[model samples]
Target: MLDYLFAALLGVIEGITEWLPISSTGHLILADEFIHMSTSDAFKEMFDVVIQFGAILAVVVIFWSKLWPFRINRDACGSGVSGLVDRYCRKDVWDMWFHVLVAIVPSAVIGLPLDDWMTEHLHNPPVVSAMLILYGVFFLLMESTVGKRRPQVRRIGQINYRMALFIGLFQFLALVPGTSRSGATILGAMLIGCSRTVAAEFTFFLAVPTMAGASLVKVVKFLADGGGFSGSEVGILLTGCAVAFAVSMLCIRFLMNYVKKHNFKVFGWYRIGLGALVLAYFYLLKPAL
Candidate 1:
């Protein structure tokens, strides 16, 4: 019914913003206001975590072909584990996976505790709005101050483990509700000398693991709580997941090409505008919730 419809709408929002440097979590918080769902605090928490699974699924489905690389060429050979891996796998995919793993560790270590705290007390429009505006300002300053630019790194393979770890460390900041993991990582890559397009693409690739792990953790927590998940609920989740997956594929394709020719300044303006609106709604417009 209407719940299913709302689920789909949220899925679309999650998919598109999840991978973008824009804050998907921030959008989800704001979008929930439009769904007419109960505002009970527990329900709101469940809704936020559950819908993210949809976006996480999008990453898995859209990037499945590249996540695990296989070489059908048969003749490619080496020696030990690396040799056997080389014999059966394309070097490019293997290299990309390594960098992703490297980039994942920092956030994983720092986020485990921080995420719990944020979920407990920080899931509100005011926080999201402030983060969106503050990060937007950072984005604007980054582009203007860092004038040296270079050709895009051709593929994820071009990134080194050192850079990957640095990106992962930068990702820790995203544990704060307002600073985006993608935004922080992208900015870190650029600061370390990656072209904007290269940084964006690498951020997209890394999201598959980072977001998936976070989503799975949430799912496990929900299940462990012993709450019943009805057939209708499952259906709603699947619909959301499907919609997010499909839309995200398109978004990634479009963003990949878009960043090659443009800068992220436009998104900065967008974040600022959205942040201002949230602030207005919470402060100047709406009565206390």
Candidate 2:
């Protein structure tokens, strides 16, 4: 029961932080420091990544119309195969998907090679705190500079192949623990002239494949290393994922509405403050005690 409660709390954290410019993995890591679950280190690690699957489901739910590329058109059915293609296939959505695929390449290429090293060494409070503060400053500076200019890509469709690849390159930077995946790509997109809404939307779309691939990798590695979940562990995992899916629905909606009228400066300040708190707790306050 207590473990389930902890899982729910972490779920809430993941759902909220995953979409925001603030880092979800950073929050989960910090949360783990205090909210120790009665599970092995391996399960805990796998739990953190797989719980994101719930959040991914939320994106699919909210954007199903945009993400799904097929529909039935009876009118075009009579015209044969060419009409079938036109009726059932959404060219725009497919194009968007292709762009998403391109955007994930850089992260896949770089992140795969360094995943183990990073998890072993960099998945610590100090690294997480440093990245939180570093990207926080980047957000502040980015907003003051290119963020003030008129955006060249005001819509997700306006994001060209070059822009998608550039954003994917930035996604590679998120291999660092505290660098939010959404934050890196969104910041990169906005820096290159995408509007805030476009950057946020593209970031959400990009997350579907990026996170799914990452979760699959973690699951495979966990199994390869002889990790197995018990019955209770499965329950805890399900609880976390269910709660994350529910909360993510609300968070994604809120963020979409929030970004239209607001800049990311507030999240920037929040990250810096939270990063300082983590550093103080781990390095200063805890050490003194």
Residue 135 displacement in candidate 1 (angstroms)? 1.0
- What lDDT score belongs to each candidate, Candidate 1 first? 0.76, 0.92
TM values, all candidates: 0.87, 0.95
Clashes of each: 0, 0
Q: Where does candidate 1 stray beyond 4 Å? A: 38-47, 50-65, 74-87, 151-154
Query: Which residue pairs in candidate 1 collide?
Result: none
* lDDT of model 1, residue 262: 84
Worst 10 residues of 1 by lDDT: 78-87
lDDT of 1 by residue, 1-289 (tens): 8778877888788778877788887787788677764333444456565666666655566667767687554234533344333445677888888998999998888778677788767778888888899889888888887634554555667799999999888887777666677888888888887887778877877877787788767777766876556777777777777788778878877887888888888888888998998899989888866
What candidate 2 gets wrong by more than 4 Å, as runs, is 74-87
Q: Over the stretch 132-244, how does candidate 2's per-residue lDDT look in tens digits?
A: 99999999999999888999998788887888999999999998989999999999999889999999999999999999999999999999999988899999999999999
The total number of steric clashes, by the backbone 3 Å criterion, in model 1 comes to: 0
Model 2 weakest lDDT span, ten residues long: 79-88
